[model samples]
Target: MDHQQLLSLLRQMTLDEKVAQLLQLATPFFKGADDAGMITGPMASLGVTEREVRNAGSVLGLSGAQQVIDIQTNHLKHNRLGIPLLVMSDIVHGFKTIFPIPLAIGCSWDMALAERSAEIAAREAAVSGVHVTYAPMVDLVRDPRWGRVMESTGEDPYLNNLFARAFVRGFQGQDLAGDTDRVAACVKHFAAYGAAEAGRDYNTVDLSERLLREFYLPAYKAALDEGCEMVMTSFNTIDGIPASGNAWLMRKLLREEWGFDGILISDWGAVKELIPHGVAEDEAEAAYKAIRAGVDIEMMTPCYVHHLAELVRSGRVDERLVDEAVLRILQLKSKLGLFERPLRGADPEREREIVFCEAHRSSARELAVKSCVLLQNDNEVLPLAGTGKIALIGPFAQSGDILGAWSWQGAKEDAVTLRDGLAAAGLDASRLIVAEGCGVDAPATEAQLAAAIEAAGEADAVVLALGEHAWMSGEASCRADIRLPEAQLALIAALKPLGKPTVAVLFNGRPLDLHGVADQVDAVLEAWFPGSAGGAAVADLLLGKASPSGRLAMSFPHAVGQVPVYYNAYNTGRPNVPTAPDHYVSKYLDIPNEPRYPFGYGLGYTTFAYEAPRLSAAELRADGELTVSVRVTNAGRRTGEETVQLYVRDVAGDVVRPVKELKDYRKLVLAPGESAEVSFTITEPQLRYYHADLTFASDPGEFIVYVGPNSRDTAEARFRLTSTV
Candidate 1:
């Protein structure tokens, strides 16, 4: 049926039917379970039967081959409208075969893997009866102290944009209208939710228009360009206006400027929280505000269900708005092929067997290996090749704390611990000396430190893995200081004097102040709390079977006081100038106003040399394009991968811009003495910015493009864009 025909059908429906299309329940209702297996009081109250919810709008947190089949079958055979229920869930990282967190995946700088991860996640999720995933969170966060940093791909807009499009492509595939498991992808947190005040989760986002467009909004636009089907509103307030009810953001920017045609869902309970935000007087008012502002669906918030109809009747909202929301929701279902073959996703054996199959597990392991970043390796102490008696010193060396945040389904029982991987890798458990140098959060015991020191003296090399527990940097787990908690640093200091080569494996969700560790340790490997096969991946990198191609997502600060340390921050009026006095300048008396480890900074076992950037054309018109190229050669003995980063800067603009912005990047694997030419095409959109009136357009001006290995170190070339319009 044509979309207009569907809209006509929706108009013919009765008021109760139209309102029923807006209802969303928490979980799926199964028929026999009410009186047979799992009897409960709530099941009896709402006439909660499998038949009832299957007839409703959609269900959340329910999927599996058999389960989805049963629900959709009911929709086809029993529901009044014969509308297939749209099943959705949080496939943040992986569905059943869990990969590393988004932060770890971001380190790969390999958009291919990110895309593949999303593809596999969609495959598993689709087989399980899921029609949508609330993912591809493209929030740009600068502060590592923010707990949800693990969920975002990175702080850089370019990297986030690339990953966002890749995720959309992977999840929805070539065609969402034809594929059963290829569900619609939701580009999240419609506006800036990452710049939370004081690095607190869901705090107010206070930023100027220049800051918002230049840094935060590009990635969401990128996802929309890729044909995402939904947009999730953020939990934070933008400039004193909660995002759940910001018309200028949702209606004006997202809908009008970006031309996004999708369902807008509020973050869990954000609609009702408008009362707390002082924007709405009550739940009824919040429903009115959010609906009027263009939010179509309320996730886990009863405000839409309880008050939307009342608002429509009271003239607070137009009835056409309700029909528009319902139409968007139904159109997404049609695109999911729910209308054509409503029971197609109901294969029981395929769903059960596909969840954690061998292929997904292998991909997870490969991603875990690729996501591991070697921050520093001195004297080539890594790739511990020879079969020697290695001393693994730390509680983490044998623990099951590798699962990063949002690991809702990953349990320790299902994970491969470090000890298990070491054993499987043929390392003698008896020969591998172990010592709990210190607790993850407590001071190091003197006796434990002595045992580790004594073991280091007798070992060929010491593998000292230190970092936070799995619960340290996720949602609601924010910290004032992101450092190696406890006395792990003290323990490392104690074992350093033993005159043995030490390889430190640091595991954490966010970046930490590791200046002291970098200064002391001979080698450092940043293996974020990887998922189920994390141990095996770390072991593979340690043995040199897989090269570490990962890079940093967030900047490592020198100390906690230097919060929000990132590469793209604006240059001060007297940047890098000798401060006349600390009081009058943006300088810290005790610390330098720079990052400990800059964004895009990562060291590989091998080295690469770069030739000066080559531009195809010296000038570009506002309506035209240009190609920027560079030759990268693997100058070291080992064959490895290097990420070529591209940064752009507007010399002068109507509005002030950052000193630099990451525009594009590519990861290349090269053999020693081999060189590869990587090029990126720049269009007018790359030069566009939000003016005072919030229109996005490029200004004819001089611009500089830098190509290099990371954000801090780069080679540059200048160009000019002529005004053609």
Candidate 2:
């Protein structure tokens, strides 16, 4: 049915029925029916009791396509209006076949993979009857200490924009309502949550308009351009106002300025927290403010369910607002074809047939191997060949804890443990010594210290896999200390004197303080939670069949105190002087303020050499575009891929730019002695900035462009922009 017809029918219904449209009830599972006593009742609340479920819409969680089929089948057969519920889940990565987290995948620097990952998520999600996903959290983060940085695609606007469009294409596909296995992607956190003060979750964000436009807004805009159907508000506050209630952001900017017509959903409990943000006086007031501000869906927050109707009945909120929200909700359902053959998409037998199928496992393995960023290698101890005895020491050495946070309902038994991978590598189980050197969080014991040293003694090379536990970093799992916990360092130090070549394989979600490990380990392989087949993937890289090409999405700080360290930071009045160590400069007293590992920092078994960046055209007119080119050659014996990053800095502008800003990047694969010319088209958008008047403008100025393997290693050239704007 058309939205007008659906709205007309909804309008004729009672107020209780209309109110029910706002409530999103939780379901148990598809295999069991609600009346079969499988469902306990409405999902347990953080605080509120189970409200009545009579006219409520439902959101599916942990339930597969079959459950969605059963739920929608029951809704059509029994409900008064036969309004099918919208099924949504947290499809952050690949749905059934888990891929790398957004941060790890971002290192691929491949827009195709970002889009492909999303498409796979959409395909799997649709197969299971999901219509929407709260994913592609386009919050540009600079803080490595903030645990959620693993969920974002790193800190640069240019890179994030490329990722944002790819994510949208993967999730929504060409047609949302028409596709059986595609779900609408929700571009999120409306404004600057990444700038949360002190690098703390839910902390207040205070930024200048110049900073906001320059660093943050581009990704969200990119998602909008890609036809994203929904947007989720952030939990944090911007300029002392809660994002869930910020009309200036949602109404004026999102809906009015950008012309976004999608449904707006609030983050969990964000609407009710307006009182703490000092915006609303009560829950009823919160309802009125958020509804007027253009939030169409209340995710996990009952404030909208219990109070919205009352606010609308009174003069506080316009009734048209309620109708508008309902209309959008119904339209999304219609697009999902939930109203029409709702049961056609779900097959119970097919559900059992395809979850974690071999195809998915293979894809997961490829993603895991590609996601491993080789941070540092000395004397080339890696590419472990020649069939020597290896000591795989550490808790993660045998761990199958590949499920990064917010994972779906899969058991540990289904996971491919690291032990499984080692066996597949044709290594003798008896010869490969194994020892739990220390726990993820506990201090090193004398026994663990002794065992690690003993294992190191008998091995040709020690592969020490060390990193944070599966739960150390993610949403609500934030940490004040980002260093390796437990006795990992002590254990590593003890094993260091064995005089054997040592390789460190880290299974972490976020970047860690690796200064100590860098000094001790001969080689470092950063295998961020590689999903189900992660173990096999790491083994493949270790055996040299696949070269590690992943780069650091976020910078690795030398110490926990340097929480928000990143590459595109501003140039201060006092910079590091080569000879003059200090007076009147932005220098740290104890240690150098440089990051332990810069963003885009990674290593390859082979090496590539890049000629200095050269501009195709010297002068750029306001309307004309020019291509900046660089030639890169693989200088080693083997084939390798290099992420050639392009950074631009405006020497003088209407408003100062970051000392360095990532404008463009290209990942190129070359064989030994093979060379390729890489180029990025420079346009006004890439050169524009938020002016002093709070408007985006392009100014003619001296510009510096750098192109190289990573942020720290680059060659620079200066050019003058003679744009006649």
Candidate 3:
């Protein structure tokens, strides 16, 4: 429908009907649901009625062909205006055919693959009757203690922005209005949710406007720039006001300044949370502030449904506010072409055929291969020969915890175990000995340890599959001590005495402190929760069918004390130089300031040597560009992939700047003796940053350019920028 038609429909809606249109409920509230469910418990608690459920504009956390079809058919029968219900789910990583976690995907540094993952996820979800996915979580993160870090790309604003754009593109394809295979993308945790204090979930976030705009806001803006259709408000506050009720953030900045004209939904129950946030005195006030601040949909709560209509009837709230919110909801359904095809893309047979098909699994396997980072491979101990008598021992040897969090629809029973992967690759049973050394978090039994030792004693080498269970890391799963459990570490220590080549393959969701494990194992592979074909990808990489190319997106600290450790940080006034004696400097007494493995750090089967960067020009004008080129040669015997990272430092700026900031990067594949020249064109606009007063521009001065394998180790060159005017 056009604007006038939508407006006409909105004008015809009664106040209660218009108010109900802004409320989102789950499947259990309605008739014809999968099960015979009722709306008593939650609705009675919040004073919402069955009539409101019938008039709800959307559904949350419910999908499946017949269920969606039944719900929609049942809903339209009672809805006065016959408005269709939008079906939305947290399809964060994948729907059924699970892929690597978002953090692992960021490690791949392959934006095309990341985009393809989202595309496949959309394909699977669309057939399952999902209309929108709350994904492309673009919040920039430096603290891994926040469990949602697994959902974000990483800490670097530039890299996270790139991945955010890719995810939005993949989720909402070019023709979202006409494509049944695509779903509307929703950028989440709007503003700075990742900067939760003390690495706690939903904790308070405090930052200056300059710092927030500089670091946290870029990725969200990038997703919006890529035309993402929806936005979800974060649970935390901006300037002491909850985002769901902050008019300055949602109205002034996002709606007016950024020009985002899409639906803005609250996080689960976040609209009602304003009461507990101490901003609103009661549920009625929560609803009043949320709508006035521009939250179009209230998910899983009755604050909006119970109070909105009354507020509008009274002199306190405006009826046009309710009308505007309902109009956006209508426009979203229209944009999705729901009026024409209410059951858009919902096909039970198609869902069964394509959910976990071989082609989709193959793409998942390839991506998992690129996502496994070889954190340590001392003396070239990896790429195990298939001929050796290998012992696969640990909790994850035959465990099915490979599918990480947010993979609710994924079939854990279908996961390929490590033993299954080895056998499927034609490794004879006689050559592979397997044992369950210990549980992920539970203490190991004496018999289990004895069995593992006996198996390792007879094998030529040992591969210990270790990690956190899928439940340990995700939303509300933050840990104060981000390390493997003691039982798993004991298994590592027990295996170290066998005098055999040992490899520890970790399947986790966040960066862990590997103090005991890395030192004890000959090799450490950070195979983050590698999705469905995780075991197969591990087998391929271990046997040299594929090489490890993944790098760290988030830093792994030496200890949890360094919670916010990252590569791009300011050089403090009293810098802690490694060579200089530690005195009156910003150095820890118990540990170092540097991360155990810095951002962009990874090890492959091969090595690369970098030459000094060559600059095309010594000075760059505001209107011109500066080209930087460098030569990289594979110094090792094996063929592998390397990500050449580009970083820049402002010698002097209007304000303090990070010592090194990631600007651009290129991934390369080289033969044993081959060399390649990679170049990047740096423009003046790329150097612009927000100043103290919030003015965005560049300060003309000397800049140092560095290009190499990772952030820590790089070769440097110099260039200067001069304003054209």
Q: Which candidate is the best by TM-score?
A: 3
Scored by lDDT, the top model is 3
lDDT, model 1, position 206? 90
Which runs in model 2 stand beyond 4 Å of their true positions?
Answer: 28-52, 60-62, 444-446, 579-581
Off by over 4 Å in 1: 1-5, 28-56, 70-79, 442-451, 578-585, 614-629, 677-685, 692-695, 699-701, 720-724
Estimate the TM-score of every prediction.
0.91, 0.95, 0.99
Name the better of 1 and 3 by lDDT. 3
Candidate 3 residue-wise lDDT at 365: 90
The best-first sequence of candidates by lDDT reads: 3, 1, 2
Q: What is the C-alpha lDDT of each candidate?
A: 0.81, 0.79, 0.90
Residue-wise C-alpha lDDT for candidate 1, range 440-526, written one tens digit per residue: 888777788788888888899899878888788887888987878748888888887887888889878898888558888888899
Q: Measured by TM-score, how close is model 3 to the native structure?
A: 0.99
- Candidate 3, superposed: residue stretches over 4 Å from native: none
Q: What count of clashes does model 1 give?
A: 1
Q: What lDDT, from 0 to 1, does candidate 2 have?
A: 0.79
